[model samples]
Target: MDSMASAPGKAILFGEHAVVYDKPAIALAINKRATITIKESHKDYTSIKSDNIGLEAIISPETGLKLKKGEIGILNYILKALEFYHDSKPIKIKLEIEIPIGAGLGSSAAVTVATIAALDKYHKRKTTLPSIAKRAHKVELEVQGAASPLDTSISTHGGLIYLNEEKKIDQIKGDLKDSLVIGYTQSEDTAKMVKLVKERMERHPTIINHIMDAIAHTTKKAKKALETNDKECLGELMNINQGLLDAIGVNTRSLSDMIYTSREAGALGSKITGAGGGGSIIAYSPNRTRKIIETLKRKGYNAMKADPSKKGVIIEH
Candidate 1:
């Protein structure tokens, strides 16, 4: 039997580093997704292949997972998910990832969620979505050392999600898909970026705490703007949120250039989407998406129009 599952990537619109401090955040599920297909193998060991990251590995209960030097981190996510299952039965795993790896777009979370969901189907476990999400979060935490449930939650549930300081999740209903634009420069280490912010906070707790509070407030206002379909207000809130992220020391020179270029091209608001050392940025360009994308492309960036996916992880057997 063959079991396949896919989950959407995410873009954090409101909070990134602040969310780690238990502040509110707003994230949306992007159409890009990571898919995993599992099948029983005749051999005595599990084989993994991922074309997106140029990875191929073979693992057994005894030999364990071994990778080449400088292998991408998705393999770690796969290994952790496999460990959760403990199904040593020889299997072949194929990963097809559309989200750029390490671009702060929840690529790791997406792949981990899809892998677990597919494994569940393959083993006839019939795991529920919530269980899969929880399990995926564990896998991420094990691999990344530190993580927030925001990415896994959004990838599992899809659409728009609001994560409050209390860790409560509220699904926001809105269709700002047409107004969303994403631009990618390069990938960054999420863990490193998170650590950098932590160091800064340790050095200046009061200042960073105030910044976190401001981000929480901005996130709440952005939620309202989405609920009422106030594009202008939401755009302004995004700019404010970006300033807070900058204050936290996640912004980069390339990211800032892309953001300002987008704004100059008529984006209502633009900011780094996640971790932000050198990842991607999101621009709120309601009617000027084309112009913003063109401008970013001319300035040398991989730009695209993105939509918030309503569907989450699903079996495709």
Candidate 2:
């Protein structure tokens, strides 16, 4: 028997750092997706293996992740959620996935959403997107420590979303038809970058005020543009956003170079897509989508054009 479920990857089109401080952020689920496939095996316990990240043993559903030799990645949200409701059975589950990791595009969150959704469906359990989102958010918090709940929200509930400061999620149901160019810089360790920001937040509180203030300004302006249905204005606000992120000390040489070069290629707006210190850049192009992609690739950047995927999780059995 084969069971499958999938979730979309996401990018923060509007807010990032400011969201941590009582500010709203806009996010969208991109076409990139993570898939979890669980099939029966002859083994006694559940096991997980990824096409890209290789193999690992599934942890016991009773206790969370174990510290054994082959248990490094056993805490997948699918297994954890199964354990959460004491629904763990001694059935062998094989895992297969295709979401690109560490691209700052909500890859892990998408994986969690997809995995948990699959598990719930497999057991014939009822769970809504919001409920699964909260569960996935908790798992991410376990990993990132200080992670906001935005990624999990969008990954589970797809389409463009306007997330409030209180983590209340609402879908932005308007015509979000803007063409987006996503580029992967693949520089800087994501975890190390998070640690740096955390360290600065702990050591130097004064400097963060100006940075957060600037992010708030851009985020607010972007939200207003969205409200007005002005795609061009939204693109312009995205450019301002990159500047603010640079001020916040998260922008790195790779990220900065890509953002600047993307602008020179006539992109209407450009910013680092995720936790920038080298992740990916999301650029909006008002005129020529192919030209924008071609320009980035000519400059040795891996770029692709993508649209917001409206559907959240798709499951099949």
Candidate 3:
């Protein structure tokens, strides 16, 4: 039997670095997804392959081998999923991901969750969303040394999610699709970026604390904007949130370029989407997505018109 599963990528609409400080953060699942296929194999060892990351390796389920160096090191998360479920049967696994790696697009979370979902189904173990998310969070923690449940939760449940300091998660109801444009600055050092923010906080705790409180406040208003379907208000909050992120020193030159360029091109609001020293930026362009995409691309930046994903993980035989 073959088992296939897929999970969507995610973006932080409001609150990035502040979320680490236990501040409220809002995230949306994007249309892009990472998919995995698992099939029992007759061979003695299991093998995994992915052209997207140019990884091909065969390892004994009993004793895994060392993986190649670099960001593809994230495959450790997938391997951890297999071990978690104790499915030792030799199998062939294939992964295909639409999310960009290290761009703060939840590529790691998507792939890890999809891997666990596929393995669980392959072994005839019907797992719950909370269970899958918990296991995926472990994988991230082991790999990143730190992780927020927001990415794993959003990848597992999809749609719009609001997460607060107490770890309460709510699925906000609204149709936010087609109202945002996402731009990538080709950042490959999320760990380094996160470290920069931590250093700033170490140097100025009081200032960082105030910024975190402001971001939390903006997140509450963001929830109101979503419930009331107020795109303009949401845009304004994104602008405010971005300013706070800039004050905390997470904004990079490339990120600022994308944010300002999109705003100048008629985006209602724009800001860095994730661990912002360098990564991706999001712009609220309800009516001018095409114009925003064209402008960003013409300026030689990687850009795409993005919409929110309604479903989390989908399974197929």
Score each candidate by Cα lDDT: 0.88, 0.74, 0.86
How many clashes show up in model 1?
Answer: 0
Q: Candidate 3 lDDT, tens digit per residue, 1-317?
A: 89999999999998787777788899999999999999888998887888887777777746766444234455777778877775577898998988888788898899999999998898888799998888998888777776778899999999999998987889998667777899997674556666777887899988888888999999999999989989889889989999998898777888999999999999989998988767799999887899999999998889987789989988786
Off by over 4 Å in 1: 68-70
Q: lDDT tens string, model 2, 1-317?
A: 46678889898897776676666788988887888877665654566665456656555556644433333432445455555643555555545554456678887788888877877777777888888888888877676566778888899888888877677887764455657888886645455666776677778788876677777777767777877778888888898888877766788787777788888888888998888877798888755667878888998888777788998888876
- Model 1 per-residue lDDT at 34: 94
**Clash number for model 2?**
0
The per-residue C-alpha lDDT of model 1 at residue 214 equals 95
Which candidate's TM-score is highest? 1
Cα miss at 281, model 3 (Å)? 0.4
Worst 10 residues of 1 by lDDT: 64-73
Q: Higher-lDDT candidate among 2 and 3?
A: 3
Q: Look at candidate 1 and tell me the lDDT of residue 223.
A: 93
Candidate 2 stretches greater than 4 Å from native: 53-88, 92-98, 173-178, 187-191
Off by over 4 Å in 3: 61-63, 66-71
